[model samples]
Target chain A: MNKKIKDEDIKVILNSMDFDIPSEIDAKVNEMIYSENLPAGFFKKLLRTSNPFIKWVPAFASILLLITLGLIQLNRNAPERKPLSEIKIEYELKDKNIKIIWVKKENFLLRRLKK
Target chain B: MTLPLFFAGEREITEKYSNKEVIISFNKFFIPEKKALYNFILKSVSFSEDSNDIYQNTALRAFKYFRKFDTSKRFKPWVFSIALNEIRKYFKNKIQSSDIHSIENSYEQIPDTQNRELAEAVYSAAYSLKNTEREIFFLFYDSGFNISEISEITGKTQGNIKVILSNARKRVKSFLGSKK
Candidate 1:
């Protein structure tokens, strides 16, 4: 038998039907959410605590770690400097003699010019 | 010097608040709907204990994936999708165990109506439906979901939902008429 049921009639029937909502459901769902949302491991627990100072600890540690790594890399890549005492300054007498001769020649030329 | 162990403890304490926040928000949004959700599950499963278990499982699943939930979209259809999946899983497990008779026994235990013949007829007709049809029927009529919302929850095309809803209403009407 084909009977036409109006959408309103169906809604009325469905709404009129009564079902008990288990009283413990709210508590149970809350408990489930609590248990499921718990921080999974040590790091997760550390990141989500309520204390203000405590909450910044991960951020601090991360920044400190980055600084430490940067310093290590900077130290590794830096050129080694020689100690002042170990640095040798050599005077090549040959070049010194050449310079002296040039000066002597200039002086002689000046003297000749004056004469 | 700050000891490494002390620093680790501080990090643990700090990290816990985000999880706490998620739980707080979940409680705020979900607690208000718990009764409605429980009633829906109860009607869908037609057994208190099964409904309770499914409800708990659904809540747990929802919590586990709560971060993935989009804030812009409505929470109702998303949560209902999870509950519907749990229902399917429950029945699949039951059938695999060859415990189909338990379903029949649970149906027999549906509470008797309080002298409302029409209500009783409607109730029986709703339960007589196949699980998918029953879900669509309830989602549309009782839960106030529109066709698109039903499609989103069930992953069915709108056309398929319309067809199923049409068939479900036909069955209900015929059953009610015969009962009269």
Candidate 2:
């Protein structure tokens, strides 16, 4: 037969048990708190550690910023290209009556030249 | 005669004002609970030296993170949660390099007392329990944390907490009855 134990009995027993903590714990904890040497915040601690990725972040950011600024500067200093205007070429028909041809200057000059 | 100030009045006024308030609040809540907290740690760890270390570590951690503590909540559960984490960390570190045989041998010796045979029995029974079971039992009975609060502390659901508490109580009771 399983005998049931009362919760009161357990509570009384546990409550009566003594734990001896050094009296100086309170003072020591208080001193630690007031000593201005508490562990730094999470972010501060993360920054403080010598992790390779974290260590390189600033340098990487600076390099990226420099590259971006250099790109912007180069873009600003670059010479602007002029847009091409339409040029009409008129060919004359004289003897055969079919010699006249009209061609765009860009197409005639660049495309025909390349071809 | 006016007393000399140790720091610049402006620096002192800003920093000390805030720090003093935090210090006062911490002391007010923690000082009174220190004994209970220590007792709980001692019971949880089942060793004086380890308990002392865990206790100090908990206090330091609680103080360090006290600013994050919500004033709307009860302080005891929050502090107990920190203590619980410290104990977990301690056990995790000890699991690999620790002597299992030594721990088994150490359980045989809980200091004897003439007047509190029941207390001794309960303690011995408690010490025999698995760490998680003992911790749950202590949090429930000795520390007065409710099921939900224990769930929050242990990061287990209320149902799980209840099951663990029931099992722990049954084991302790059975152990005690066997001893009788």
**Which candidate leads the pack in lDDT?**
2
lDDT of 2 by residue, A38-84 (tens): 65563244224413354567899999999999999888856777777
Candidate 1: list runs displaced more than 4 Å.
Answer: A1-5, A18-20, A35-115, B1-17, B105-115
Model 2: native contacts recovered, as a fraction: 0.41
Q: List the residue pairs that clash in candidate 2.
A: none
Candidate 1 lDDT over A1-115, as tens digits, reads 2246567876776666556656586576666556654446633433344234566778999999999999998888567785443333444478556322222332565679899
Ten contiguous residues minimizing lDDT sum, candidate 2 chain B: B2-11
RMSD of each: 10.6, 9.7
Q: Which tens-of-lDDT digit does each residue in B91-124 have in candidate 2?
A: 7777876743344323333446542566666777
lDDT score, residue B69, model 1? Answer: 70
> Against the correct fold, how does model 2 do in TM-score?
0.64
Q: For model 2, what is the alpha-carbon lDDT of residue B89?
A: 85
